[model samples]
Target: MAQSRKKAVKKSFDPQEVLDFLRQDELDYPAGAKKFGKDAIPFLSDLIEGTDENLSMKAAYLVGYIDDESVGDVLKKAAEKGSSTIRIAAAYGAQKRSPEVAEAILSRSLEDNNPSVVKFAMKSVSSMKLGKKLKSKIDHISKNFLDDDIKNSAKDLIKKIK
Candidate 1:
């Protein structure tokens, strides 16, 4: 009897193929796309700026996992102007960047009309170590928001910050 050894094969990273995978409606594509890291930033940036909302959202999520600082501005822009889903993805990505940059973008997202965006923003706010000014803003949100859930989230975030 002879024993055979199996060799592992390494596949090259293809930015276009990663983008295509992200564009699909399947749940695993984003995780699969994240393996490209900084190499995927350019393609993800283009997708974030593109017209396809589903692909753009997935790109935004993957861009967040990449550790490139240049993507911050793109994520901020998407968070400000993209659709609610894109905004949520952008917010998630923005939180992975520098806290100073992310804090400002997340703060602005708190004003978004979409509850999901606001909720994501609140979660980001809670996770970070905030300054006096930002804490005051969260306190204000807790006091003034008409939505009970948002108000409670704000209040809970304030408690966590303190």
Candidate 2:
């Protein structure tokens, strides 16, 4: 009797397939698209900056799975420059980056014209080390933002910061 040895085969995914996976509404870490690693960054960035707000938002969240310093840059940029929906997703996605990177993104989000982005930023800030500048920014929002929800959230965050 002869014994047989089996060799493992590497699985490959088409870029479109990975994009489809990342576009899902509910996803956790170790997402199937993560198998592509940094290679997925460009594709994901395109989607984040793309026309479809829904896909852009999902891509922003999925960017965190790449685990690269550039990933922080991408999320931060999306937080500052993308549409309101993407900014909200970017604010949450940024929590996975380093403290400084996350703070940079959150700071921009705090000033976003969209109240929802500011609210999401406040939520992210609650987990970060609130600095004097951030505390000041939140204080300003608590006092001046036009939206009642964001103003209230900023007030709550100010209490937490103190």
Candidate 3:
């Protein structure tokens, strides 16, 4: 009986069930965020070009957590792709991963010509705790982007740069 029981033990997880679950939306973004981690670099690179701007942006945001250099490229592209929400999220994501990418985003955002994007970009940069390196970049943009409002906002970030 014990031998029969051992041989008859059923699998707890069915492969087909796993595939069906993976097809759900809730299982996609944040779940993808947790599972892919650094291994998502290649998948994100492709997702950036997807027709769904929201998905592209979501993928971009998650890609930043990958802690890989390629995430910078994807984030930069997302910021330039006209999905304001995605750009802001990617900017913040990049801020946590790469200072250079964050700086590039701030440069565009500081002088963005789009008030909303500039506002979001300023907010994102202000949240960065990147020390002197980010401070110097902020100073440069503050002086150069100098649109009064954007300059003042960047100054606020400079004060927080400690």
Candidate 4:
């Protein structure tokens, strides 16, 4: 029967639908785990616009966790355009999924005025741990970190980099 045949067909992929899901999930649980599949990744990618910082940050976080390299550019762009909170989340999230961007994030983290941003940057730098590469970078920017605790933390991190 035509009805039966139609029922057998799968639902069509809709970018808007996935975006709506992301928005709803983000609102419900910003820090909790979310599972947006491949079909939804593009929608999440487009949501990286800085217009809505919270939403953008959530999307970036989800995309980063998805661990898909395709979303790298959008995540990085969100990091650049988003508010400090959003930027920290975006940068931290993106870096976990892609170590290639770690160097750029370290530079931004060093210059960042926000303590939270610097902290996340430090965490990411520690995660990447690229032999001597991080040592020079951390040494050069150690003074920019305003908080002595953070400065000392960065120093401790540099020693562990090797």
Candidate 5:
């Protein structure tokens, strides 16, 4: 008797399907849906570039969880133009996937109009190796940000960097 062999078929990329899969609350980093990083890149990229703010933010965060290095461009773009929530997520993702770009993105985020974005940017910056230029920029933010909370946070980061 001859056995029939089955060929595996690759599924087409579907943003909605990937979004649905990612929407589950139990997904954890280094396991779960994060293991599908390579498969989810295209869908997550579309969502990051989409106009829906909430979905875009969700997608940005998912990019961070995903292990693919190709996520750098999408994360940088989202960090530059996406809403504060998306910027925070993208900054984090970029920090992990593309440290060089993350420095610029996080530095630019320090000037974001939203204090929350600046706060998260400060958090990301703290994880990086602080050099003279970045330390100077952090000093400027600590002295100039309009929000006292952000200023204090920047000041605290400065102390940590020192």
Candidate 6:
């Protein structure tokens, strides 16, 4: 009975375990997040949609680590419609996925109003072999963006794309 109970607790919610694991000083959120794998999505999504600033941001990034098919669409939506904070996290999270999978989020983030989002998105896309559409957008950004850092990043991307 004890073995079955342990299995149930591990598979299900052991509230105390979550508190203990997440509260650790060196809390490896990615590792802890994968504990529940895809099952943690609804809870993490709630936290991202919640009003708490820090928690929302953390949850937003954690969603990227979920090994599930649904995570991509979820990240894309957040990258597109979420607040600047979530957008930034989405950019960061998108980097965890394949370049092809992450391309759209990175491209949109490069066009974001938030400089931080644009900056981080540039960093994410920097290593990817950008497609023509994205290269053209980068060229435009290089020519039009006011921030030298972002403009420089766009210019760099243009060189690589060519």
Q: Pick the candidate with the highest lDDT.
A: 2
User: Distance (Å) between predicted and true CA of 105, model 1?
Assistant: 1.9
Q: How accurate is candidate 6 locally (lDDT)?
A: 0.74
lDDT of 1 by residue, 16-117 (tens): 778667856765634664567666677778888889888888878877777677778778888888789889987677667788888877877877777788
Tens digits of per-residue lDDT, candidate 6, 13-103, equal 5445654554455657678667766666777677777776666666677788777767777778778876788889888888788776788
CA-only RMSD, every prediction: 6.7, 5.3, 7.9, 5.3, 4.5, 3.7
Q: Rank by TM-score, descending?
A: 2, 6, 5, 1, 4, 3
Winning model by TM-score: 2
lDDT of each: 0.74, 0.78, 0.62, 0.63, 0.70, 0.74
Off by over 4 Å in 4: 1-35
Q: Candidate 2's C-alpha lDDT?
A: 0.78
* Residue lDDT tens for model 2, 1-162: 122221111235357776667667677645643666666788889888888888787778778667888888888789878788899988887677788888888888888889888888887888766545489889989999999888988888787767
Give lDDT for model 4: 0.63
* Sort order, lDDT high to low: 2, 1, 6, 5, 4, 3
Expressed as tens digits, the lDDT of each residue in 38-154 for candidate 4 is 445676766766477667777767666665556566556655666787668765874665566656655565566777877787777776764266576567556666688888887
Error (Å) of candidate 5 at residue 32 is 5.3
Cα deviation at 41, candidate 5, in Å, is: 1.8
Q: If both were scored by TM-score, which would come out higher, candidate 2 or candidate 3?
A: 2
| Cα lDDT over the full model 1 | 0.74
Comparing 3 and 6 on lDDT, the stronger one? 6
Cα lDDT, model 3, residue 5: 60
| Cα error, candidate 2, residue 162 (Å) | 1.3
Give the Å shift of residue 31 in candidate 6: 0.8
lDDT of 1 at 17: 77
